[model samples]
Target: MEFLFQILVILLAARLLSEVSERVGMPGILGEILAGLLLGLLIVEETETIASVAELGAIFLLFTAGYKEVHIEDLKASSKKAIVATFFQIAAAFIAGFALGRFFGFDFVESLFLAVAFSPTSIGVVVKTLLDMGYLSSKPGSMMLTSAIFDDIIGIFLLSIVVTVGKYNAFPTATQFMLLLGKLVFFVGIMVILGYRVFPYIFNYVQKMHSKESIFAAVVLIALFSAYFAEIMELDAVIGAFIGGVMLSNVAVAKINDIQSKVSGLAYGILVPIFFAHIGMAVELEALNTLGSFTILVVVLALLGKLIGGFVGARAIGFDSYESFIFGSGVMPRAGVELVVISIGREMGIIGEEIFSAVVLMVVVSIIISPIILKFAIQKDKQKNTSVPAS
Candidate 1:
């Protein structure tokens, strides 16, 4: 009964706040997060069941992102820019984070974990904002999505390395690094074969079934199975869920759209909101109060690192100044993966509450700021284009 009431209150609060946020020209997610913060102030307990549901929310959120936003073929065809930009973005952010940690007197391992936390762009937040602004299919959006895919894969791999080293208090040997790379390659190769050569045929038959939800069921099963497979292999489950969605994206466009709508309804309406709220609830407000300087430093570095890296990479790939700035703005927000990285670091005792709280604050601030900047960039671009003389 208590659990039921908790869900009810969270849902009601999230919906109301989200509606209010949208009306005020802010992202609905910001409101959902605020709802969580409000509830946290009012209620002290966070149950295990709530945590489990939140995890599901994250999974479904990524799964739907892959299904709706990513286009593998498009990513492959124009991946050069994304790859280069992702490299620079990760490099810049990682180095900046490490420097900040060292300045604060953290040990090498802790500094490295902080670096890893800042390296990946959070696709969930970026995708939501782009979709909201009707830019998900624009050139800048494609670049952001493709770059984010690489960011996630590389980030997770780096995280595995960091966690292993932190656990043993020793750097990984060459052989250990090779083994990790081998595992990653093997997973991708198998997913490619199964997704292309096997799953389509199976899904084709499933689509013909008379049951109303067969396609949806099959897609969910595949997503869950892929997530389980990745977790068992010591990689992030969201990675698998995302790849699974990408794999099935081209199989049955019409039926997939239907399934996507239903999944989106389930995710956004309930699961995803809970995920955002959980992030809010988990924040240690007291830690933030004590870590004010550190929080400010992190927020600045996290924003500028990704922004500069993205801008430079986009320019190198031939985007004009305005477009490059938009790309930079698009990748500035960090949330889902950043949270996961820091949470794991904290659990391993490699990061204290202060650093964790500071990063959470950074994520929230980035989330709020990135979309507003991106929207501004988009409108500016539109005005510039409109004023240009016809060729």
Candidate 2:
């Protein structure tokens, strides 16, 4: 009964607030997050069940993101720009965090963890924002999605290095680092093989089944399986889910469209809301009381780092100024991956509570602010394009 009540309240609040947000020219997620934060003040404790459901929300969000909005060819086409963008974005964010840490008298290991925390762009946030603004199929959107994927991969590698240093007080050896790299390569290689060569036949057979909804069930199963496989390889599960979605995108079955619609409905209408709200509920609002100049600097630098990195990378690849700004805004929001890194660091005693709180604040600010900036940039670009005569 208690669990049921919590779900009921969360859903109603999220939907109500989301409607309000959308009517006001902002993304609905902003309201859903606010709903969670309000409930957080009253609920006091989050149940494990809620957390698990939220995790599924994220998985399904990424899975549908890949299945519906992004095609394999889009990913391939954007690969070069995505790589360049990700390289600059990660490098800038990492440097900013490290420099801040050193300036504040932290040692090498602490500084390294700070750098790792600053480097990742949240796939869920970026994808949700792009979907909200109807830009997921655009060139900037494709690049953002691909760049976020690479960011997660690099984040995993950096986290591994940070953990090693924190636990053993030394950096990972050359062989150890190589083994880690091998795991990443193997995961991507297997995913490509399975997605291109194997899953097509499997899904084709499933769709032809007489069983009710067999294709849908198979897709869900494959998504879950892929996510689990990625986890065992020390990679993020969202990556696996995304790859699974991308792989199934080329299935030529008649019901593919229906399946994608169902998947999208389930993800966005139910699960994804819970995911965003859960992130909001996790915020310790009291952290605001502890904010200082250093915390303010951390937030500023974190946002600026990604913005500059994305803009520079996009411009280098010949994107116009407006397109570059859109890309920069798209990469600014940090959530799940950043939170995980800081939480692990806190637990391992590699960073103090002060640093952890500052990063959390940064995440909150980014998720709240980035959507508004990105939405405005997108709208402005649309207006500009429409004003010009077609070439």
Candidate 3:
């Protein structure tokens, strides 16, 4: 009964706050996060069940994001811009964050962890904003999604290197690094090949079943299986879930579309909101306040690093100033991957509580700010295009 009550309160608060946020023209996630923050301040204890649900929320969120927003063929075709932008974005952010950490007196490993924390854009936030604005299928949206996917892959790889070096107190040997990379490539390559060739036939057979929920059950199973596979391979489970969704997308678009509402209903109605709120609830407010200036600096660096990296890359690839700004702003938010990196760093003792709190603050602030900036840039670009006569 106690657990039930807590769940009820959380769900109600999240839904109410999300509605308010949407009514104000902001993303509902902002309110959901704030709801979590409020609950954290008020509730004395958080249950393990809640935590477990939040974890599932994150997984389902990523899976839904991949299913809806990303297409592998499209990603491959437009790989050029995404690759260039992601490389520059990660490099710029990592350097800036490392420099900031060093300025604050953190040692080499700690500074590198800080750099990794700032490097990945949270595609969940970016995708939600794009979807809200009806731009998910647009060119800028495609670039943002693809860039974010690369951002996660590279950021996670860098994180593994940082963690290994921190644990051993020495840089990994060249051969060691190559082996890690090789394993990652092999995992992705095999998943892609099998997902493309085998999974479609499996799903095709499943689709012939008369049970209304059979396809949905198959999707959930595949997502969970891929997620487990990735974790066992020492990669992030969210990455596996995303890849699974992408593969399923290629095979069963029409069938999946048929059940999209049912899947989305389950995710958004419960799990995804919990994930966002949990982020807010996890903040250590007192620690954040004590490290206020440092927190502000981190947030500034995080925002500028991604923005400038993305903007410059987009411009280099011939995007107009407005489009470039939109792309840059779209990729500026740091949430899911950043939080995971910081958690790993904390567990490894590479970062202390103060830095953890500050980065959490950075995540919340960035989550709030990035969507607003992206919305403004997108609107401005639309107005500019509207004002121009068709060539």
Query: What overall lDDT goes with each candidate model?
Result: 0.79, 0.78, 0.78
TM-score of 2: 0.75
Top candidate when judged by lDDT against the true structure:
1
- Lowest-scoring 10 consecutive residues by lDDT in candidate 1? 249-258
Collision pairs in model 1: none
Q: Residue 354 deviation, candidate 1, in Å?
A: 2.5
TM-score of 3: 0.81
Candidate 3 local lDDT, 33-114, one digit each (tens) = 7898899899825677887787777677767767766666665675776798788778888889999999989888888888
Angstrom error of the Cα, residue 265, model 2: value is: 1.8
Ranking by TM-score: 1, 3, 2
| lDDT ranking, high to low | 1, 3, 2
TM-score of every candidate relative to the true structure: 0.83, 0.75, 0.81
